[model samples]
Target: MPNETLAGLTILVVEDVTSIRSLVVKLLERLGCEAVCEAADGETAWHHLKRRKFDAVLLDFELQSDDGVSIAWRIRGDDGLINKAVPIVLLTAHDEARIVEAASKAGVDDYLVKPVMPDRLGLRIRAAIDKRQDKLDRQARSTEVSWKA
Candidate 1:
């Protein structure tokens, strides 16, 4: 990841596997993100997400308790969330077509398979954030228009 892309951003990494979670955190540190919050399970992730605002979220597709797609759906639907339109990266070993389709429907900004490629992780994260920003900007513009669609 580019150092400037993620500098000073607060990121949330949600993974059930300890080793994978640690690896993700190390990568985030390498990206120069000083504030990284971690959640080992789906429920814990939900609490953290509701209580704080994150610039981006890196979440496992399948959790021990809560699933990533479901969580993403909730986040997208929840108006009260700290950042309801935040970018989401769905990380998992399952890269089936159905899973990818589900992720898209759930509002995932990016999708990466496990044994996640280190070379693309940063780029994907940056891309997801950029995409989310674009979506938010469009929404803001639409709201400012005089005519309603």
Candidate 2:
């Protein structure tokens, strides 16, 4: 990967806890992201998504109003949203197989347990972005091929 690959990226962080959100934003800044927006709940995050675009979303598993799984599901299923394909990385305290499975089924691109290390978080973000980009490229190519036929 290129140096400071995340330098121009905009990220949305959805976490109900103020301290966690702040910590994540700080780390993202240090990791070279240009912008990091914070939302305390799923509804707020959805609103932000409608108003602006983000390169990725970091979502907390437990929120006061909406859980990360439901938020991720809504994002993936919502046909009207332009940011539907945005990569979602779920953060949670649980490391159980059930939690990870549920997150995967909800369309989360990545999962990280609590007390996330900066290095691991950076790696996860890079992986998720690359994965999303690859999927978009494949879809675009398929569409082009279909149109040519």
Cα lDDT, all candidates: 0.89, 0.91
Off by over 4 Å in 1: 1-4, 146-149
lDDT of 1 at 141: 90
Encode model 2's per-residue lDDT on 1-149: one tens digit a residue. Answer: 33474788899999999999999998898888999999999989999999898999999999998899999999999888988999989999998999899999988999999898888988999899999899889989888743454
- Candidate 2 segments exceeding 4 Å error: 1-5, 144-149
Pairs of residues at least 3 apart in sequence or in different chains that clash in candidate 1? none
Q: What is the TM-score of each candidate against the true structure?
A: 0.92, 0.91
Best by lDDT: 2
Provide the global lDDT of candidate 1 against the true structure: 0.89
1-149, model 1: which lDDT tens digit per residue?
Answer: 35555788899999999999999988887777869999998788889998999989998998988889999999999888886888999998988999999999999999999887665888899899999999989989988958578
Clashing pairs in 2: none
The weakest ten consecutive residues by lDDT in model 1 span 1-10
